[model samples]
Target: MCNQTTTAEKSSPTHIYFDSPEKHCRGTDYLCCSISDIISEAKSLFNLAFPIALTGLILYSRSIVSMLFLGYLGDIELAAGSLAIAFANITGYSVLSGLALGMDPLCSQAFGAQRHKLLSLTLHRYVVFLLFTSIFISFLWINMFNIMVYLQQDHNITRIGQRYLLFSLLDLFTNSFVHPIRIYLRAQGITRPVALASFFGTFLHLPISFVLVSHFNFGVSGVAASASISNFFVLISLVAYIWVSGIHEPTWEKPSFECLTGWKSLLKLAVPSCVLVCLEWWWYEIMIVMCGLLVNPKALVASMGILIQTTSLLYVFPSSLGFAVSTRVGNELGANRPYKARLSVAVAMFISAIMGLSALTFATALRDKWALMFTSDTQILRLTSVALPILGLCELGNCPQTVGCGVLRGSARPSTAANVNLGAFYLVGMPVAVGSVFYIGIGFSGLWLGLLSAQVCCAGLMLYVVESTDWEQQAKRARMLTCIDIRQPDDFDCNKGEVEQPLTCSA
Candidate 1:
C-alpha cells in the first residue's frame, strides 16, 4: 500500500486531474508536487526497481553458466544446448512468464484494497494454471527430437537437444511455483527476498553444475539437471523465507475448491499477456533464423548471438522498471489514489528514458570493446561493432515501450498492448526487415533496423494509450477486480456506474 492522506484531501478532485502545481488541496494533498515530492517518488520507484533488476541479472547469469559448461562439453553439445534453450524459452518460459503476469494487477490491487484473501486465491489459481500448462510443455519437449528432425536439424544436434530437454522437465513444474510466487511477493512490495533467494540459488548452481557435469560425468543431462535443481532451490528458498519471515501470514489463504474455478478473470488477462510476450520473444528467435539465411551466415549468426546477449543484458533495467511501475500503479489504483498511479507512470517513464539514453551512450562509446567481451574473431568483432549502435538505438525505444506495456498491464488493459505489439512487430517491423535485408541488401543490420522500427511504433502507441488513460476509470476497474465493497465517503465521489460488475469478482 501507499501513504494515506487525510479523508478531506482524498476527496479533492483537483489532484485526480493532475492539475498545475499551484492547485494544492488541504491537508498535504496537492494536485502538483514540489521538487522534493518528485524526488521522493523517484526514490521510491528506484528502491523497487533496483532489487528487481539485480534479481534479473543474477538469474540471467545462470544461463551463462549453463552455456559455459555446455561449451566445455564440446561444440555439438553447445550448439544443441543453445537450440534447446531457445526452444524452451519460446515454447515454455515465455508462456509461463506471461501467464504469471496476469496475477500482477490482481495481486497488487488486491493487496492495495486490503483484500488479502483475494491475493492468496489468485496466486493459487495461477500456480495451478501454470502447472497444468507445464504438463503440455513437457509433452512438447518429449517430442522435440521429432520436431527438430522434421525441421531438418542435424541428427546429432537434435538427439542432444532432445536429451537436454528431457532432463530439463523438472524446471517447468518448479518454475510453475517460482514465477507466481515471485510476482505474488513483488506485488506486495517485497523484492529483497526474491533477489536474495535468486542469488543463493545461482550461487549454488556453479558448484552443482560442476559436480554433475565434471564429478559425476552426467554430461548434457547434468547441465539440465543443474538448472532444474537451481530453480528448485530458488523456489524452496522463497517458500522457506516466507514461512520463517511470516510474510505470507497476512495473505495466505487455505486451499479451497474456489481456486479450481474462477478461470474467467485470470484467463481474460493471461491469454493476451501470453500472446504479447510470445510475439516479442519469438521475434528474436525469428531473427536468429533469419541471420542464418544471410550472406556469410556463420559470421552473421555469430554476431547476432553476441548482440542478442548484449541486448538481454541491457534489458534488465527497463524490464525491472516496468515491473516496478506496474506494481506501483496497480497498488495506487486499488487504493483509490489515481493521482499516485499517474505519478508512478510519469516518474517511471522519465527514469526509463534516462536509462535508455545512458544505454545508448554506453553502447555507442563501447561498441568496439563490447564485442571483445564475447569474441576475438575479427569478422564478428567488426560486425558486432557495426550492429552495437543500432542495438543501442533499439533500446532507446525499447525502454519506454517496455514501461508502457507495464502501465497497460497495471491498468488491466493488456489487450491493448497485445494488439500494439502485433501491429508494430508483425505488421510494420517484419515487412521492413524483409524489405531491408533481402530486397535492399542491408544485411544483418537490417534485422536490427527492423527491430528498431518495431520499438519506435510500439513506444509511440504505448505512450498514446498511457497518456490518454483515465486513471479514475482505471481505479474503478481496480475496485471491481478486487471485488471491494465500496462505501463512498461523504466528501468523495466514487464515480458510480463508471465500471460495471463492481462486486462480480466475488460472485
Candidate 2:
C-alpha cells in the first residue's frame, strides 16, 4: 500500500487517467531541463536497460548451455534434442506463453488506472488456471515424444531420446508457472525480483548439471534432472515472494467468475499470439528435420544446434523489449494517454532493430567458430558455415518482427500480428524457401531463403499496423471495456458508444 499511486483513488472507470507529465513537472518545471536533466534521463534509461538485459541473458542461459552440452552428446541425441526442443518450444510456448500474455495488458492497465485493488485475485486465479493448463500440455507433450520414437524406428538414439523427453516433461510443468509470475511482477513495475531469480536459477543450474552429467555420469537424464530441479526451485522462489513480500493482490469478489467471464477478451488476444509463435517454432523444427536429410546429418545437426543457441540467446533482448512495450504501452493507453503509448512503441522498436543488427553481425563473424565448438565433424561444419551468413542476415528482420508482434500485443491487436505471420511465413515465406531446396537445388540454403522472406515481410506489416493505429482510438476502447467515463474528443470514437471492442467475442 505504501507504494500505491495517487491515481488509484479516482472513481470514474471510463475516465481513468494517466499521470499528466505537465503536473509531474510542476516541481522540476520540465518545460526545460538543464544539462543535469539530460544526464538524469540517460541514467534512468540505463537503470532500466541493465536489469532487462541481464534478465534476458539469465533466462536464456540454459538454452545456450544446453546446446553446448547436448551437442556433444552424439549426432543422434543432438539431432533428436534439437528437433524435440523446437517442437516443444513451438507448441508449448504458443499455448502456455500466449495464456500468460493476458496478464500484461490487463495488469498494466490496472496499475496505470490505479486499480491496485483488482490485482491480487486476478493474479491468484490466473496462476491456478495456468498451472492446470500447463500440466495438461506437459502430459500431452510426453505422449507425443513416446509416439515419435515408437512410430519412427527403434535405435539407440530413440531410446536415449525417450530419457531426455521424460526429463523435459518434468521440467516443463515446473517452469510453466515462471512466465505468469514474471509477468505479474513486470506489470507492477517490479521486475528486479524475476531478473534476480533468473540469474540465481541459471547460476545454480550449471554446476548441478555438470556434476550430475559428469561426476555422477547421469548423462542425458542427468542433464534433464538438473533442469527440472532448477525450475522447481525457481517456482518455489516465486511463490515465496508472492506470499512473503505482500505483493499487490487483485480481489475475487464472491468468486463471481470475473476471470472466466472476461476471458473472451483474453482469448481474442491469446489465439493470434499463439499462431504467431507456432508458425516460427514449427518452421525451426522443420529446419532440424531438413538437416537429417542432408549428407552428414551429425555435423548438420550440431551446427544448427549452435546456430539455434545463438539465435535463441540474442532473441532474449527483443523479447524483453517486447515485454516492455506491452507493459508500457498498455498502461499508458489504459490510462488514456495515447501519446505516451505511441512513444513507448517507438522506443521499443528502435531498440529492437538496433539489437537485431548487432546480433546479425556477431552471428556472421562467429558462424564457423560456433560449429567447431560442438564437434569436429568437418561436413557438418562446412554446411553450417554456408548457412550462417544467411541466418545472420535474417536477424535484422526477425528481431523487428518479434518486437512488432509485441507492439501489436500491447495494442491488444494480436489477431493482426497472427494474420501477418501466417501470410508472410506460411503462405509466402516457407513454401518458396523450403521448396527452393528441392525445386531449385539450393539445398538447406534455399530453405533459409523462404524463412528470411517471411520474417521480413511480417516485420514490415507489423510496423505498418503500429503506424496505422490511432492511440486516441485505443483509449476509447479501453474505456468501454472497463466501463469508465473518460473524455471523448469526437464523442464518435471507433467504439462509437459501443460497450466493447467489435472483435471481442467468445474464445
Candidate 3:
C-alpha cells in the first residue's frame, strides 16, 4: 500500500511520490489505476457520509419527537410549539450552527496539516464565542413573550411560545459546547462516536418526552425540557467517549488567551457563513409568514408546514454529503494534496446527484400520501399533493447546491457562496414568489415554483464556481489560514502574484 502511486501523486509534482515510467507508458495500466483511484475516493466519501447522515437524521428526529408530543396536547399547543421552535431556529439555532461552521476549514486543515494543538485552540476559541452568543440568545428567549406581544401575535400562542422557549434556554448553552466538539471530531475523521452519541440521545428523547408530557402532565414545557435534556445527554456522551477512547490525548490542550488573539480571521469566515445560511433559512421562514396572508390562511399555513417538515426531513442525506465533502476537501488541501481535494469534490457531487434523483422519484411516487403523515384535512392534502412534486424538483437543484456550498466553505471561499445566495434567493426568488402568488394568482403552487427557480439558479452558479476553482490556490490559502501562528500575520500574503510555501511548525 505504501508503494502504490495514486492519481493525486501522478498529477502533482509537489507530492513526494513517483510512478514507474514503464507503467505510465502502458495505456491499460494507467486506465486501471485511474479507475482504482476513483473507486477509492468514492468509498472514502461514502464512509464519511453514511454515519453523518444517520446522525443528522437522529438529531433532527429529536425535534420531530417534541412536535409529536405537542400534537397530542391539541392544535393550539402544537401550533405554539411549532412557532416557538421556528423562532428559535431562525433567531438562534441556525445562526449558531453557521457560525460554528467557520471552524470547519480551520479544524479540518489544521488536522490535515497535523497541527493538533492548533485544532485544540481553534475549538476553544469557538466554544467561547458560541457560549457568549448563547447568552444573548437566552436573553431573547427570556423576553419572547414581550417580543411577540409587541408584534401583536396571538395572545394564547405567545404565552405558550414563551413558556416553551423559557424551558429551552438550557439547550442554547449545551449546543454551544456540542457544535464545536462535534466539528472537532468530524475534522479529524472520527464521526462514528459522534453518530453513536446522537443515536442514544435521540433514542432517549421519545420516551422522556412521553413521560414528561403524557404521564407527568408537564405539557408543552415538558416537551421542550426533554429536548434540552437530550442535548445535554449528547454532549456528555460525546465528551466522555472522547476522553475514555483516548482520542484527545494528542490534541487536547489547556485553554489560554492565545485562543482570543485571532478573532479577525475567524470572523471573516464566520460572518459570511452566517449570512449564507441565514439568507437561505430566513427565506423559508419568510415564505411561511407570507402564507399567513393568503385566503384561508390556516389551511395554507398547515399545508406549508407539512411541506417544510417533509423537505427538512429529506435534507439530511444531501446535507450530510456536504459535510463529508467539506471535511475531505479541507483535509486534502491542508495536506497540500490539491488534486485529491478536487477528486473528492467530484465524487461528492456525483453522490449528491444520485441522492437528489432518488429523493425526486420517491417524493413524486408518494406525493398523495406524503401529507397524510401530518394531517387528514382534505384541503391540506390537496395542497400538499400538488406541492410535493414541485418540492421534489426543487431537490434536484438543492442537494447539489448544498454540496457545492460545502465545497466552497472547505476551500475557504464562503464569500462567493454568500453572494450567490443573496442574488438567487432575495433578488430573484422572492420577487418571483410574490408575483406568482399574488399577481399571477397561483397560490401555494407559485411559492414552490419560485423556490424551484431559486434552487436551480443557486445550483448552477455554485457548480460553475466549483468547476472553475483553482485548487492549488485553495491549498495555499488553507495553509496560510490554518498553519500559521495564532497572531494575525502582517507580511504573509496569499495572492495570485505571490504564493508562499506551506508553513512548517512543531505540533
Candidate 4:
C-alpha cells in the first residue's frame, strides 16, 4: 500500500508538498491550526482591514459633508437632498458598486495565480460595462422629477430633489471608472494609495462644498456639483498615482478586442453580485420611501437620512473586514491553499464581532449626540435618537453577516449570497417592517426593528453556509476560474491531487 501511494504521488503533477511539518501546517486543512497560527492570521487580516476601513470612512464622509450642508440650508433642503441621494443610490451607485464587485474574486484570484493578463482584461471589461450602465442611470436621473411626482411625493420636495439628481449626473460617469479601478487595485493588495486619494478628495470636498453651497449659495445644485467635483478629483488622483508609481505595470494588460466580447462568464457573477448589493441597498432606500408614508414625512425622511449616514459611518469597519477577507480568501484559494482561505474567514468573523460590539456600544452611548452632527430640527433629532439604539442592534448582526458575504464572494458563490439576502431582507425583514410600522402602528422604531430581524437572519444563514463550505472544492473552482482561456469541467481530484485536461474557450 505504501509503495502504491508513493507511485500515485509521483504521477500526479498537481500534488502539493511541503518542505517541513511547519510548512505542512501552513498549507493543509484548518484542523491542524494552532493558537499561534490563529493569532498570526488575525494580525494579517487586520493589517489588510485597517486601511480599507479608513478609506471607506473617508470616502463616505463626502456624502456626510453634503448632508451637513443640506442640513444647514434648512429642513426642506435636507429632506430633499436625502431623498435625491437615496434615489441615486438605489438606481445608480449601488448598481455600479455591485457590478464592480463582481470583479473582486476574478481579480484577486488572477493576481494570486499570477495570471496578470486575466486580471487586466477583467478590469478593462468592467470599466466598459460600468460606463454603459451609467448611461442608463443618467436617463433615470433625468426623469427623477416625473417619477417622484408620479409616486405622489410633495411637489416642493420633488422639485428640489429633481434638481439635486440632475446636478449629480456627472458623478455617475466618474464613478464608472472609480469603482472598477478601486477593485482592480484592491485585488493586488494595494490599499493605502486608495485611502490617501480618498482623504485628499474628501478634504477638498469640504472647501468646494463650502464655496459652492455656503459662500456662493448655489443650494442643492452647488452641493451636487461639489460632490461630483470631489469624485472627479479622486479619480484623477488614483490615475496619477498609478502612472507615477507604475505599480500596475506588472499586472496591466493592453486593452484588447477580447474585452469587448466574452462577457458571458463575467455577467454570470456580476449579475448576482449586482442583485445582492441592490437587495441590501434598496432596502434602506425602501425604508426611506416608507418614511414618506408615515405622518409628517418631511421630518421622518430627514431623520431616516441622518440615520442612514450614521449606519454608513459604522459600516466602515465591517465593510473593510469584508473587503479584506474577500481578497485574502480569493488569493489563498487561487494559490490552492484552502486552509489559509478558511483561516482568513475565521479571523475576519472574530474581528467583525468585536467591531459590531463596539458599534453597538458607541451608538447607545451617544444616541443623543450623534444626530446633532447632521441636523438641528427638534422632531428629526428626537426621531433619530429613538432609532439609533435599534440601528446599533442591527449592526450586531450586520458585521458578521457582511464578512460572510465576502467569504462567499471570494469562493465564487455570489448566487448563494444573493439568495440569502433575498430571503433575509425581502421575505423576512420587509414583512416585519411593514407590519410593525403600518399594521401594528409601532411607529419609526419599528422600521429599524425589521432591519435588525433581517440582519440577524442573514448573519445566521451566512455563517451556516460558511461553516458548511467544502474548501477543497472551492480551491478547484479557483484554479479553473484563473485559467482564463480554459472552459471545462473542474475534474481535479482532491484526494489524489490529480488535475483534468483543460479545454479551449468556445468560440
Clashes of each: 0, 14, 0, 0
Judge candidate 3 at residue 93 and give its lDDT: 88
Q: How accurate locally is residue 292 in candidate 4, as Cα lDDT from 0 to 100? A: 82
TM-score of 2: 0.83
Top-TM-score candidate index: 4
Return the lDDT, model 4, position 251.
87
Clashing pairs in 4: none
My TM-score estimates for the predictions, one after another, are 0.89, 0.83, 0.89, 0.91
What lDDT score goes with residue 316 in model 1? 92
Residue-by-residue lDDT tens digits, candidate 1, 1-507 = 233344532344443324565555344544455677678888888899999999999988987788778767865676567667767888998999999988888888888888888888888899999999999999999999888677665677669888899999999999999999998988999999999999999999999999999999999999999999998999899899989999989789887899998787679888988887888888886786676555665566556666777888889999999999999998989899977888788878888899899889989999999766555669878988999999899998899999999998887788899999999999999999999999999988899899999999988898878877777668878887776646645553333434464322643
Task: Write candidate 3's Cα lDDT for 95-180 as tens digits.
Answer: 89889988888888888988888888888989999998999888888888887667655677668978999899989999999899
Would you list the C-alpha lDDT of every candidate in the order shown? Answer: 0.83, 0.66, 0.81, 0.85
- Residue 378 displacement in candidate 1 (angstroms): 4.0
Identify the runs in model 1 with alpha carbons over 4 angstroms from their true place: 1-30, 74-76, 152-156, 216-218, 294-299, 485-499, 502-504
Q: Give one digit per residue, the lDDT tens place, for model 4 in 1-507.
A: 000111222221121222233543342232355668778888878888889988998988888889989998989999999999999999999999999999989888877877788788888899999999999999999999898878878779879999999889999999999988988988888988888889989999999999998889999999999999998999999899898999899888788888888678779789999998999999999898888878898999999999999999999889888998999999988777776887677778888889899999999999999889987788988998999999999999999999999999888889999999999999999999999999999999999999999999999998888877777678887876765423434883322333632211211
Where model 3 places Cα greater than 4 Å from the true spot, the runs are 1-33, 146-153, 484-507
| Count of backbone collisions within predicted model 4 | 0
For candidate 2, the clash count comes to 14
Q: Identify the candidate with maximal lDDT.
A: 4
Q: Rank the candidates by lDDT, best first.
A: 4, 1, 3, 2
